[model samples]
Target: MIGIENIIFLIVAALGIGLFVWQIRKIRKNVLLGRDVELADNPSERINKTLLVAFGQQKMFKRMLPAVLHLFVYVGFIVINIEVLEILIDGIFGTHRVLGFVGPLYSGLMALNEILAALVIIACVMFLWRRNVTKVPRLATGVEMRAWPKVDANIILVVEIVLMLALFVFNIADMKRVLLAGEEVVGLYPVSQFFVDIFGEDPEQLYIIAKVGWWFHILGILAFMNYLPSSKHFHIIMAFPNVYYSKLLPKGKFTTNPAITHEIKAMLDPSYQPPAPEVDAEGNPVMQRFGAKDVEDLTWKQLMDSYTCTECGRCTSVCPANLTGKLLSPRKIIMDTRDRMEEKGEHPAIFAPNHYKELGVERVETTDEKTLLRGYITPEELWACTTCNACVESCPVNIDQVSTIMDLRRYLVLEESAAPASLNAMFTNIENNGAPWAFPASDRFNWADELYVPSKN
Candidate 1:
């Protein structure tokens, strides 16, 4: 019973899904290239946080106008996709309105979908206007936003508009076709009904237009699916898991290195002993690096954070260092991480050959000397951060930008001994005087002594 059109649809669907899955797998492999860290504690709390931050979009409400517009696009796009299921069924079985058998329920669903599609088109237009016409400072002015990032944003918005248009065209043409045949239209087309006259009363012409629109809509969805992995729109999928695994600790609390903590403990207590070093596959002892010199040194969650970034620039807009004209932009930091990951991903053999070598399989070597720290992100940018969690609080997805910054700082200080001059002095004071002040511990109470007289009451 299968027709040529149905067979072609099946092949295209299979190919699209296969390509999407392959890219997703590659992204997973890249994310897993980072060191592992446990974030599984408090599962219930994490789920609640995910619902509030990702699903509820609580953090985005800080800026009301964009929030409302984004909500329209977000909700409309998702709800409208219910029609994609019907489209899929119709495409595969070569049936017209396959879900039309649902009777009046189908009418209600179609009406709702038509309304949402219209809203989505409106939202996407406003979004485009904001980016191009209004030139919103945060969205427009970042070094990272130049060229491809800007183009990518516009592409997604325009694509959404076109897809919504295609839906309307398909509906209008189908309604015209039904009317021409003197058959009862199965579904309500509130938005499309107004435009049905545009296609004329020619049944064959309506049929062709309907088929074209249907094909374009489904094909566009498949193309958009594959494009997500390379676009900031990936956050649509990544945000939930990223928010779920986000740090639950207080913003001001910094995570200390376990090795450094053990060393401090040993120094403070004569009876304390450090834990034994981890051993490799051959029983050779493995030493831990001080901090993140590259993406591999960062936690997998941090890498996911990079991929999940919406590039909204809310974080950068709130950043004190950037406001003061410093080299640091929190948005840039995340973008750089993602760029570095992509660079490394392209040359898997040079960075991640152990897996292949272990399996006795050879991979081509593509040598590149770049690293996340010096190559993509600079030392000045890392040091410019004030350790304030303003960026963290501003992020809609709850990306821990500060944590990544701190890890890079740790690598600079512990591994390279490259802390800033002022910080180096403070470190010396802490070591010799047990405080950040330059005065020795013996003189610590001198100011208090001067204030305290032999006052006997």
Candidate 2:
């Protein structure tokens, strides 16, 4: 006894599931192209943590107004969709008017739906007002901001308002159908009955209006669903996964080995890999400076951090380098990583393969002028970093850039035998005296009680 709409529902349901599976696979595949992949130990624990952070909105609730407004929008939108279940029922039975046993239940659901739809419309307006008046920083610094986003957001707001308005209109139309058909509408839904009282007329015309409104509402939802994956609204689709796998990594957690404390001569001049961390007699590691010359030198997890950046420009806003007029923006660091990844895409159009291969590594070894000056980072900014945690700490997605800088610093000091002249004596003092000082060893150990040091093994 199923109707044409029921058959269509089955097809759409199957297609939706298939598409969802495909997208999950695509996301996982794309993840490898990012930097981090380690599961961080226990899968179940991490999953629970991710779900709590995401669903609880515990972190977001701290932000106040946006959280409350967004919560209403999220809740109301979900409530409006409850009618979709009734739609499917109507599709199967060739009518949605659930009477008899569950008549009161249907009435209550309809009333709740109407109220929630209106709330959703109200929330959309509040969001647009915030964007225009308060000027959300995300909207302001957006690199691609132009006619499209402004138009899109405002248009979406309009659409939500119209859709909510249509719901009430449809309800009134439906009430008229109930009246003309000589059937009692379970009176739990007050809004539609009120409209029928104030504006009752010929029921046939109202029936047509009901169908038109229903069409608009259904079509709008479907169009928005398809658009969700492609628009800025993609965040809605992506936030769960994005926040779920978010880095629990502490600030400045170096994905690359922090430093090779003492240098071991590589077997080949192009530096075929050597055994790591050649150590001295005291069991301390003896490895020369450590650093990454290019993209491959960084670990896969580091790349993930770059890819995860929401491009919210939160880092750029707080960047001391940008403030000081230096070319370095922490935001640009991840953006540059993204650019480099794109540049090396499967079939890159133009490539200068290793044309400037002699990185700070080769340059320091050869004392090459090209490497010393005008490298990826200027010496001034390199030295200027106060190890300030501002950029990384502020980043909502927790992209780490300072650690990359530190790795470069390690290479300069350890492997290349390159240090500013003033630092040479300091390095010498540390190297010869087992510490970075010209002061006597007794004085260094003086903080500990003399009795505590001498009698020790």
Candidate 3:
């Protein structure tokens, strides 16, 4: 008992779903290009963190007004989407208001939806005003926020406004149609009830308007879903898991790569037997590149952090290096990582079966002229970090921009022997004198002898 209209609805839904799945697969493949990392510890704590930050929007509340406005849009969007389920069911069955049989419950739900839709529209307008008129410095100042990013933010707000309006108009038209046919109002449309007078009492016209509004609202939702993967708004979906998998260590504690540590120890003690190279689940030795020369050298969690980044620029805004006029912007570091990853995803020459053959080489060459180190991010930017952890502390999603910077720095120092002159001098002092000072370790306590000390009571 499937009609042509029902078949068309099914086809459209299938296509939307298929496209979203394809995009998701592409993103997963891109994220998997990163090196393996273990962040499986502390499940209970991670869940709690996710609930507090992502679900509760705890970090966003630090700035009160914007957070409230965002909460409106966020809560509204989520609550309003509940009605989309009913829309889908009705579309497939070619039935009108199928959930209306729920008596008073349906009316309550309808009232709630209308109120939320109105709130969403108002919030979107306020957000647009804040971005365009007020020009919040944190949002507007960064180089990354230029061009497409600025437009993208505005575009999402406008689209949300349009969608909310469509929902309101659809309800108004539906009520008008019901009134024209002398039918009783079964559902409440609190906000849209005011619009009933605006939409006059022509049954045929109201029906057409209602149909158009219904189609636009659903179609807009589908388009928004697909748009997320390519937009900074991908944070909406990524924020939860990103917060859950966040680095649980103390902010200032640096994680030294074990492979590098073993090598250093072997160099220091000739009799020391370095531990065997760690093997993966597949029994293959996990290749340890001293530092990140490209995206693949970074850990998978780091790659995930790039996608999860909201590009809110809080990290960069608080970054001492950036604030002090150094070239390092923490936000730019994350954006570059994401950009390089996306570039690799698009080209995919590295993963091709006949990649070596195509390149006319013995082994497959993954890297080309471009690299994460010198190509996207410069050594100057890497060296500017004060290791203050301010960037990590400021990040809403807990993206570890500092770790990525340090990894690249490790590559420059260990593999390329490209440390800056001042650091090289310090390194030489450490190696020969057993400390950062040029003087021997025996003289380290010499200054203390000249100073007066208080006696313990």
Name the best candidate (by TM-score).
1
TM-score of each: 0.92, 0.61, 0.90
lDDT by residue for model 2 (270-312), tens? 4556556656799899533246444444445454555555545
Candidates 1 and 3, the one with greater lDDT: 1
Sorted on lDDT, highest at the top, how do the candidates line up? 1, 3, 2
* Candidate 3 residue pairs in backbone clash: none
Root-mean-square deviation of every model: 6.2, 9.8, 5.7
lDDT of 2 at 82: 71
Off by over 4 Å in 3: 268-271, 278-286, 347-368, 450-457
- Which candidate comes out best when scored by lDDT? 1
C-alpha local distance difference test of each model: 0.86, 0.57, 0.82
List runs of model 1 lying over 4 Å from the truth: 267-271, 346-369, 446-457
lDDT of 1 at 95: 85
lDDT for residue 241 in candidate 1, whole number 0-100: 97
Candidate 1 per-residue lDDT over residues 111-207, each given as its tens digit: 9999888888888999999999999999998656756788889999999999999999899999999988999999898999889899988899999
lDDT of 3 by residue, 184-266 (tens): 98789998877797867778889999988988898888888888887778898888888988888897787777776787889
lDDT of 3 at 76: 88
